[model samples]
Target chain A: MSNEQRPVWHKRVTEAISADELAEREALWVPLTEEVRELVSTAILSEVDEHAVALARQHIRAAQEILGTKVDTGSFGMHVNDEGLAWNWGNAATGQKNAVAPPLCQVPIADGVRYEADFGAGYEGPPGCLHGGWIALILDHASGRAAHLEGNGPTFTGTLTIRYLQPTRLGPAVAHAWVETRTANKFVVRCTLSTEDGVTAESEGVFVLARWARKPQED
Target chain B: MSNEQRPVWHKRVTEAISADELAEREALWVPLTEEVRELVSTAILSEVDEHAVALARQHIRAAQEILGTKVDTGSFGMHVNDEGLAWNWGNAATGQKNAVAPPLCQVPIADGVRYEADFGAGYEGPPGCLHGGWIALILDHASGRAAHLEGNGPTFTGTLTIRYLQPTRLGPAVAHAWVETRTANKFVVRCTLSTEDGVTAESEGVFVLARWARKPQED
Candidate 1:
């Protein structure tokens, strides 16, 4: 299918689902996925017997067969609305239970948003420090979410710049993002990532509203 | 422990392990971790009963208890040498079978390096498109690896800038990184991420040699 003709979820769809319902569903899925995520970490680090691995694979395959193929189609499945509800449970950065997600919790603040998460051994990069890429992932998600909240529409990251100030330790980390400026459909968002010790990284991102959402005058 | 007093892995240690041995170990670890990774993705997407979930958790806990904790240390575990043999199989970005790792295989070429990997559903951000943050993860890794290969030692990412030209589809992808310029301990590197269709995103990164690696003259 052509780019324009492809099945895409528009920004307006955010209104179709009630925030309370989405939040409730997310609550249910998050813990289930979190269990699976912990399972992954354990499987990777643990030295399980071949018999256990075999049995686990059998169970996994059975589950897969039962679930079949169901795909999520939308703003890359990471859309966050004004209510601070995002239906991106399958996303790697913020999806609850997604093995790859840091599973950040979005907290609405006065002017912007804050993400709370903890990185464990699964996210290690340097000794006790959080992996730099994972750091980028968190900032990228927070920035995009910030843009979506401020822009009131679907947006995609155009450019992201991150500077590693110091080693961010694994465990509880906080990331905050706010819209620095907006002109037409473009948003300039800035973010800071920190741990108990202090700021570990900072980032700036330019997010452009999806093509379909852009006003003719802006184009 | 104080940051300065912590037992950080010195860049000089890359010389401690032979390149051939590291390569061999990575070759072995990659497939094993790949299995664990597939298990994770499968578990997340699978449909299982509460009993299955409970059973899976039990099995996972048993494994964790049996294995105990063994943390990897040194170079923050992302070290790659001049020859491009990085002992970073435990890293989140490129570690084999690491659910977090895209598990890129670095191929040394004349004047640059190429990374090859497949991003599956676990890394998805927009429907079939690879997660943008994961995109950043791959670029950040390739750029840092490029700097390490060219600069003759370990380097950390100082700044990374990425532009998403289009939605990068999930599946086999190729990323290439080359050094653009250098000044003292700072090296500028450029990277491009693409699938069979063509270039999806491009990045430029500034990498600075770690503090302990810098010489008095370079400082």
Candidate 2:
């Protein structure tokens, strides 16, 4: 597995933008992403009539046309700069440009990566609980992030095992992940998801650094 | 274990809407949800100028306002009827009204549950691959759906173990799940996610029938 020759299928665009330009672009898009997420939550809870739904559709269509006027083909692969700055805004877990992503805010934790998100109507599962699949997503993302920080390269999920101890309620929830063990190129990470009801889900995962992304100066 | 008294936390609402009304509602909301998903993908790959971006925001805001004028209080829990019709269009895995859900289309199969989805920019993780978390989601959902049909109750995922054999490329992916073993109230399900590249990920899961959802006539 250490020398697994997986093809590099990811998009890595080399951009000439400066740090300031990247920040400016993020500023421009973050609000739009947030608003669209809000729109999703609202749409889920909305009990509007036919007329209102029609009007909403009209406005949404207009927005689509405007945005679609000039678009890039395929997915939003990672955009990296020569100065070593990299951003993948379309990431499914924590992408700033992904409205479907969970509204997770990463906290500066002393031990591992801590993420806090209010599981709303949009994240419902059994009744008033966060979907079990989202639990897996959060753990995978947090664990990969933790591994990425330590590995200093892209870490892909190799295997994941999760236990749903309790139904994660739809409200403020927290996730904490840290690398439990690691070799030269692989990491074992553990994570937990908790709400006011305490730890609802936990996971253990294997992550490995992509062979192509490895640097010659090994640890 | 069969008599495990886990708290019934799932929302089971009895609505008075007719079957015809339910179909009508789905027709109305499914389009809105679909368009929003398209918007999300568009926003991720859009490289539009400042003016178009600004204009898109305004239209999106207007849609939000119109939808927000009348809203419900909380999550769209399962809406059931006296005639045994149930609809949870806000479900995370395949809710018709949920724009955040992967665009999965369930196909009728003789043995188990089957689902197909075209993973786009909105579901990217590694470069051009589907996020690992979403793979877990699809497997969990398809397996639970399979168990639900045979068990005749809402089945919750108790434990899940997934082995990602290869990178699941973003595009047409198929999932097939079936109950491999079963007890009085618990089902051991197996599922696999496949793309044109072959089976990329597979899973084994424990699904338990919700005690509250069990009918008096047991198998």
Candidate 3:
């Protein structure tokens, strides 16, 4: 089926920035994001008393004040360059600038999409287990990425159905997604989340390439 | 309808701490969590040069070092007191200590359950819209909370089906969840997500109270 329906919200930004500048900016933000993520994990497990906690808060507030001096107005939507490179650095699944996003790293696969992350203290739900919500995010992202690669543009998840086989442990986990079938604008994809205990959750999703995003079909 | 099925993982921790200490600890971490979340939003919008960025990193690192000095091992699961009060500040939905969680504030309502949050850049997707995965998280958590209240114990989402009516816009949004039907242990809950754009997403889920958590029936 085709996704002839109009999207409620979508945007593409083409910025006039060089490749070198982008790389340099990424180098700066990536470390800060990682450190912020680590700080979260550390805060959860830290047994510090009142004095240390108070001092940490002071340091955090100072950092915030410095960064807040110059701010943008709204969300970081998709930004692309003339070189055919697109990046959404605020993406919740694997944004370079987002600290709350799981540490999902894309892996090269011959026919599909793969992502790996070591689920840590901040990602836990039930004791020693990955949160159910994060699982949904991972499955949706991996499947969407697979569809985006095949469709050669952006894709949104129309519907997703997930089955929880067991609780996923809070450690290294992998997600692998591949398209099962496709039409002119819609693609059906399947994804699985696995850990040391084997497959913990699996999902089937319908993703759509909006009409405006479709490439011209070669005749 | 009852869940006799054993869970993959669940635990209850009764700590040797008092109410005063708990309150003091909460006072310390809540602000830090808020600041960190705000810092993430600021970093996304900041157009700062390298000097400002470099300086901000030092402050963030200092905070991390101070917090990381005294750390515990593994995840922070459910912790309770002898007074029957429970707190899981590490929860992914609205954990007071978790910076990644949406700022969900529970509102007292006569029916079902209600939660409100102003989703910001950290929760953004599709331009100025909330991510689909987070929609899933909000719906799941709201429904689970409803079930937990009625069942008077922990509940799990067995299956959830979400229909995305439109893209939920960023900023203030509300989640309303209510139990549709129930038996001795199983509940079918329905939830709706709305922003200024009306109802954007809705869900129906099956929540089960694990057998081990159920209380004895009256004679």
Candidate 4:
């Protein structure tokens, strides 16, 4: 359809979801994802030479405070098309520091529940090895997003499983996710990370309602 | 025991575990954990200024590469007497940064297996939040560690699950981790990241093989 011919609510649909709405929506936060990509890119490009790395880190900290800091994966954005297509480009495993954002990639296999991406630079840890926490972050986001895609009610991780099969070296890395099971609002998602050699890590998570966080709103 | 009265092996134990030994002991790099504690403390104290953070990170990366790294229970060294009694004082999470040698830290309990730690100006990310990758580093380690404590076989994480619950603000945030299940060599570990109000992100992981790396002559 021509841009002008689109439905009026199309504007609302495309319009950025409010932060609250983003949080309330199950695994959907595309607007915030764009903002984060920009934020991280700016932080990366503005580093001072004397302490480029430190400067980049400071920027990350500031972003976390506003965005809400945690151990691994943090708040990212998502998108759901009218065609039921969903894209999650934020909450990247790496590349949150560069001018070019890491691709929020997806795969058609696994019933559109699997995905992967590669991010780099200021995010490095243990020399060439990817930071352990970063691995967890990506797995969490991928699996959680997978669970959300499984048509389950809002779910939060109640349990998690991880296995570091090998030392994940830096540079290009691959990730994959898939839904394993669903009962009621709970969805089980499984995923893995791999290097050129083979699988480096694998994970699974159980997403459930925060129940208390899901209280009915006042009229 | 007095220094002179201590056993020769005890003195060797007190001495830092060599990088070679660390690599050879893949089943449980307990020696490497000790070294990491020292290394983290050294890196933190070597320079408190923002410029020195990179240097600290470099040292940590170097040690991790040579000696390998291990997940934690927020505590590092446990002084065990011949009687099986243990007193853990080398915990990175609770120890002083300057005295701790390596910068290893125990992520305070945020909820379950979720946790948060600020690299601070000493450890910067894009601008404010912890480096996204660093977040993963901690989470992966924690997930694997939780799995180890929960099951049999020298547990290594076969998989990890995480969700960027929020941006993971840089300041004082919290992380949580817990075990979901244990079946044979497979153990499931879960984690979460949160700011002051409540849980912002969550993670889940599975650890398997128990001593996958531990073979008679592999190392």
**Winning candidate number (lDDT):** 2
RMSD vs true structure, all candidates: 5.5, 5.3, 5.8, 15.8
Off by over 4 Å in 4: A1-103, A152-154, A209-219, B1-137, B141-171, B174-219
Can you write out model 2's per-residue Cα lDDT over A73-113, one digit (the tens) per residue?
67787889999998888888888998878757799988989
Q: What does DockQ give for each predicted structure?
A: 0.32, 0.50, 0.43, 0.07
Better of 2 and 3 by lDDT: 2
Docking class of 2: medium
Q: Per-residue lDDT tens digits of candidate 3, residues B69-103? A: 99766667777999777887877778888888876
For model 2 the local lDDT of residue A129 reads 73
**C-alpha lDDT (0 to 100) for residue A98 of candidate 3:** 85
**Model 3: DockQ against the native?**
0.43
Per-residue lDDT of B64-148 in model 4, one digit per residue for the tens? Answer: 2222222221112233444433322322232221111123455445433444453332223323344344355566656665664
Which docking category, incorrect, acceptable, medium or high, applies to candidate 1? acceptable
Which residue pairs collide in model 1, if any?
A33-A97, A34-A97, A76-B126, A126-B76, B33-B97, B34-B97
Query: Which whole-number lDDT from 0 to 100 does residue A92 have in model 3?
Result: 73
Clashing pairs in 3: none
Evaluated on the second chain alone, the candidates' TM-scores are 0.78, 0.91, 0.91, 0.48
**Cα lDDT for residue A29, candidate 2:** 93
Which portions of model 3 miss their true places by more than 4 Å? A1-12, A215-219, B1-12, B215-219
When 1 and 3 are scored with DockQ, the better candidate is: 3
Error of 2 at A34 (Å): 0.8
Fraction of the reference Cα-Cα interface contacts (below 8 Å) that each candidate reproduces = 0.34, 0.73, 0.62, 0.10
- Ranking under TM-score, best-scoring first? 2, 3, 1, 4
